[model samples]
Target: MLKTLPADSRPREKLLARGAAALSDTELLALLLRTGTRERGVLQMADEVLQRFGGIAGLLHTEPTALKAVSGLGGTAKRAELLAVMELARRAAAQQLKEREVFSSPDAVKRFLQLHLAHKAHEVFCVLFLDAQNRLVEMRELFHGTLTQTSVYPREVVKQALALHAASVVLAHNHPSGTVQPSRADEALTQTLKSALALIDVRVLDHVIVAPGDALSMAEKGLL
Candidate 1:
């Protein structure tokens, strides 16, 4: 049935005619999958993938091994393709971060953090080191913790800052429970990090808490 559709209405052709932004998720996925099985059309298969995975971010978060269990997307090659696509997206985000002056483009930093932290099943503490002018020097995942908590060492963070010659830093962590609210511990930790970094003339610009859907800035809330 998909093959019989007018060429202009097909996923690939439609994408070419109207641009990628004009395509729906299902249509974009159909272009990636390329073909459907005897039992279903590519468009139908893409819809099934979206339904089973809970959306694009959910699919991106899913392990490649786990995708083997998905009905239509069973082969290792398909899973590898998905992983490659995700990697490309991550690299693109990282490249964008590298090109921009940090803090000046707050949304770019948020996008980089969302790609790294959001949808993660466990907590992660991350830091972005910056020069005196706030251009990004580097980003690191400093610690990992369970569903609700992560251990952060102010000393280790300061050590890294010194090594990188960073004059400032932005802190971030994810709440797997999908809430951007910072706990008292989060507030305390921010102060501790701020004090420690201040010893070396480094500044703490913000502590962002990433949830599944959004992120919040502690500095903006006067918590830092």
Candidate 2:
């Protein structure tokens, strides 16, 4: 029981004394869970939750309906809290990009894309429409696909760029398989998009492939 656990080992007390960064993922989650059912300790429940969901990234990707099924996770209230936490993190990331010169903040852009796409259950093709000076106009996810592949229509991409009057664009997609390597299909898609965008004088700045903790920039690899 948490009550009998050493004060130094208790989630809240340790959080107060050692700070949030000092806690492990399970410890942090236990703090959020607050209390356990009669059958399991909060820490055990946290571990089970993490294991069932495949850890933190998986937790981020989980749906509300699925979260509601977890025993001792506070049902709908916990699911709502978790979702709010994730949205807050997402908006914070977006706000950072909105305030900065996006091209100059390549790492920030990559971080945003990773957060947005890496945990997705399927492929997502996205674009960052940029102005003549390479400032961000807007970012949008245009297509969603299966575990391995997504359909990317070059003409549609070009149309959107033209609609936004964007002078340049950066392409991004996530590989759910956790490999940042660009497949031949990925390379071919990038070239197709580049050629199509060129007709309107829109430049293809880069195509970034995002995985869980990795990102690859095609331009950096001389593939663009």
Highest-scoring model, TM-score? 1
Q: What is the per-residue lDDT of model 2 for residues 56-149, given as tens digits with 9 covering 90 to 100?
A: 7667656567788898765666667788877777788787766767767788888778778877778999999988778788898999999988
* Worst lDDT 10-window in candidate 2: 57-66
In angstroms, the error of model 2 at 202 is 2.5
Where model 2 places Cα greater than 4 Å from the true spot, the runs are 52-54, 63-69, 103-105, 132-135
**lDDT by residue for model 1 over 51-162, one digit each (tens)?**
7777786666555666788776787676777788988887787777667778777877876787788867899999999887788888999999999789999999999999
**Candidate 2, position 134, lDDT:** 80
Q: What is the TM-score (0 to 1) of candidate 1?
A: 0.92
When superposed on Cα atoms, how far off is each prediction in RMSD? 1.8, 2.7
* Alpha carbon lDDT of each predicted model: 0.85, 0.85
Residue pairs in candidate 1 whose N, alpha carbon or C atoms collide under 3 angstroms:
none
Clashes in candidate 1: how many?
Answer: 0
Candidate 1, residue 6: Cα displacement in angstroms equals: 1.4
